[model samples]
Target: MTDTATTAASAVADATNLVPSTKAVRLPGAGKLLLAQIRYQVRLLISSGRAIAVGAGLPVILLVASKGKDTRPDVAGYAVFGLTITAWSTYGVRLVAAREDGVLKRWRATPLPRWCYFLGRILATALVAVLAGAVTVAAALVFYGSHFGDGPDTQLTVTAALAIVAVLLVGAFAWAATATALTSAIPTVEAAFPTLIFIYFPVIIVSGVLFTNLSEPHWLSTLATYLPAQPLIDAVTHAVRHTSGAPFLPVRDVIVLACWAAGGLLGAIVLFRWEPHRSTQRRAARIQQ
Candidate 1:
């Protein structure tokens, strides 16, 4: 019994002396992940001509379309509008599709933080949106003779910059929410486009993209201003119009945009699914088998 006790004590001492080996790991921070995501997204955009065409070609086309027309100043507004729509329709849809395909799920399962992943996507999307907007503005200036009489003043510039950031943040949140709702109900990626179109078209129409002023009732105009696309449109319009001592400051527009951003973010946080349907199905099948 003493020998057995000595043996156990020796084993315990040996076990205590044996330290568990740890693997050296390096995890990316939110900023690093954002940069990485930006690089990846830029590469993807470069590879696909869609981004380039939208950034470079579409502005030229719009310029040509608006030449010798009644709606010359409207061209700049339309260009910005198109950029916003493209961001929401194309990039937003792709982001959701990637998530639905389990790319996001796999990435999340890694040691890499989820906030890092989201930051990366947001960084990437913002880069693309800004690049596209800049190119469009340049085209509007060169080809369409469009000019903002006062070039980016302290107040106007600050407002415009803040408005652009607001548009991106709110737009991203809105897309995330819409994507969650669609993916939860619909089964396929192809269906996402239609679902997005259904939600976006009405907003775009009511946004006064085609018509600068709404012919509808005062309440309708007030209601329309609160919609996602309209507030952004109003912000863009204010930037371009830049009439000194203008009657309206677009306070309502900014508030509406903020509300949409907050609501969508809340919805997305509550509803977004990390796993793909296929993985869920396969796991269930294996469990049953």
Candidate 2:
């Protein structure tokens, strides 16, 4: 009896030791999350032909329209700049609309890290923007005889890197802030672009896309420089022109973009709603009906 009892106790101890420890599962790292988000956004873009057409088509149309007989370098630069700006703006607006449509909201509710969600959208946008920018540059070079300086490969590389970074920052912030502010007011994905246009058109005009130069008052130019598109335009123009000087580091453009991004992030945090307005409205109408 004593031996049997001892055996049973040992068996129980062995069983307890055999049971797996309750180690907490670790969440993905920031890098992994970012990659996942990028993949997801890319997949979404591929799936939606309409989105791709709009995103890619507008740039192509502008390029075709701006392509002139002379093929001047300045013309090429401006054309690329305009196309890139449009791509960035379009992507930003679409991103917000998709998020407000509940895709991002659903992902946010999951166990996935928030950084992954945000980074994914950003990465996807960056990829599209870079590709679009490259195509725009190539088209300008081929059709307009546009050319960049043969400065050591290093300079070209650095300039390109800076340009992409600036675009991503500006684009992300514009999309986030515009989306949040409009969503707060309209609370529907359908209304996102129309609401954003009120802000977008003014920036486009002040950025001198239409004018030969920012011939506005000094204060207007200064203020416009701080707006999203102008800073990006200034950065692209300086880089393309290879204007080496104290004021042309592209840092000012980057700072303005950072401020926009920060402001948008804050607004999104404060006002983003997960529930669809249509659904809510439908339920209310049903209750009344």
Candidate 3:
């Protein structure tokens, strides 16, 4: 080789040799990494104007407006709705978009475990759900004079408060798990957004929370009974009622939610990918059309 080429090759080799093959940098604690991920997810969730309106603002309005005999049930329903907005729209959109855009792919290259990332998303959304529920309850106390029907008894308040928290946390996790699975399996954001809309409206409006009675045609009631939304609504509704000293029936609701949570999470774990899927290619083809 010429002297110039030999000199250039030597310089490159020296640079390559200067790079450390291994460093003793300590990996972060699991807790810290998880917290960082949660912080990112929560920040992303609140950034969206639509998410703020649907997930936070609407519930506040509903709580204030829903003054009457059925106030407790209405409050529970809207609380679930708010939680749904966080999980289904807020988190789902971010996850799918990030995956398609290679952001998740880059995350996979880091030292952060994928499960921690998933856990952070779940934790953040669930936290939001609990906060929304708490806010709704506080609003009721302030605006409606705490007419939750259990009176000022300390025991009743304690029991109801604990139950509400438990119920909201469970429902939030379940909803977020299901959302994760849906977004993971769906190919494109363009397709998933519309699918979410079609599913969200009918299920929320006609099924359980909004219209607790589906017995108009009998089959409607049976259909509602079998659907995922009803049971979740029932669980939330019963929690509110039970806490307020009303009778509770949560066996079916809990069962349904558990089933959805298990199935959805399993699907998400199996289907999730770090890179964009064929959905992108399909979008490209559509654009060319």
Candidate 4:
């Protein structure tokens, strides 16, 4: 009986040794994860025909319509318009829709860090916005015969180029953050479009995006001076005109943009939500109705 028991124990030990041991599952590094997320977000943007059409194509068409126009104020305004749409459509409406659709909630349950996801979204938006701005500017230069400076003889200095690039990047990120932050106020995906348009159209009008804001009332122009779009347009105008020197940087505009960027980021952090405000039943009932 003792020999039989010993043999059984030996057989069990041999069987255990023959089985494969499980190895620990390793996750991708944070940097890799962030890069992957950014790529995915950019793909999502590119795949959306409406996003490309409204964000990129519209501004180019507007620029083409105003052929032979000056580069400084006119092209600058159109370029900024492209940036605004890029940021708003990419982050604002998209995020609100994602949250209402439970995509954000599902993301929350994933192994990906929340910060990584948000950062990736912001970066992707900024990148696309900057590209849109660049395309508008390039189109102006190529087809419109517009030069960077006030005159054809005025060559673009390294410093001025740097300033323009810096402003484009900063402005893109600022607008993106502002758009995403505004998503907090948007309760439903259905309300996102008209609500954003209602708010944005007025600001752009006052900011002189459509026509020159110069013709507007003093109070309206002053209010727009403190707003986001005007500053961006002002900065771009200055840079495009190659008005370089100590005061080349539009200090007031930059400050206002920086303030808006800071405020928007803070608001986003404070008001962010992972789940939909409306319940599933309510959404279904609304759908049925």
Please name the candidate that would achieve the greatest lDDT relative to the true structure: 4
lDDT tens digits, residues 1-289, model 2?
6999999989988786766678987766777777767788777765765444654455556667755534333332343344434344455566556655776678778988765676466556556555555555555556545344223321333555466445644654454454444455566556666766666666667777444463578887778777766776666666655545544336877788778767866775666555666667888999998
Q: Residue 189 in candidate 3 has what lDDT?
A: 72
Model 2: residues >4 Å from true position, as ranges?
1-23, 46-52, 69-89, 92-101, 146-181, 213-218, 243-248, 284-289
User: What tens-digit string does per-residue lDDT give for candidate 3 at 14-59?
Assistant: 7968666686878799899999998987777666555556676777
**Number of the top TM-score candidate:** 4
Candidate 4 to truth, TM: 0.81
What 10-residue stretch in candidate 2 is worst by lDDT?
148-157
Pairs of residues clashing in candidate 4: none
lDDT of 3: 0.70
lDDT score of model 4? 0.78
lDDT (CA) for every model shown? 0.61, 0.58, 0.70, 0.78
Q: Tell me each candidate's TM-score.
A: 0.73, 0.71, 0.76, 0.81
lDDT of 1 at 186: 49
Query: RMSD in angstroms, candidate 3?
Result: 6.4
Instruction: Between candidates 1 and 3, name the one with more favorable TM-score.
Output: 3
Candidate order (lDDT): 4, 3, 1, 2
* Alpha-carbon shift of residue 223 in model 2 (angstroms): 2.3
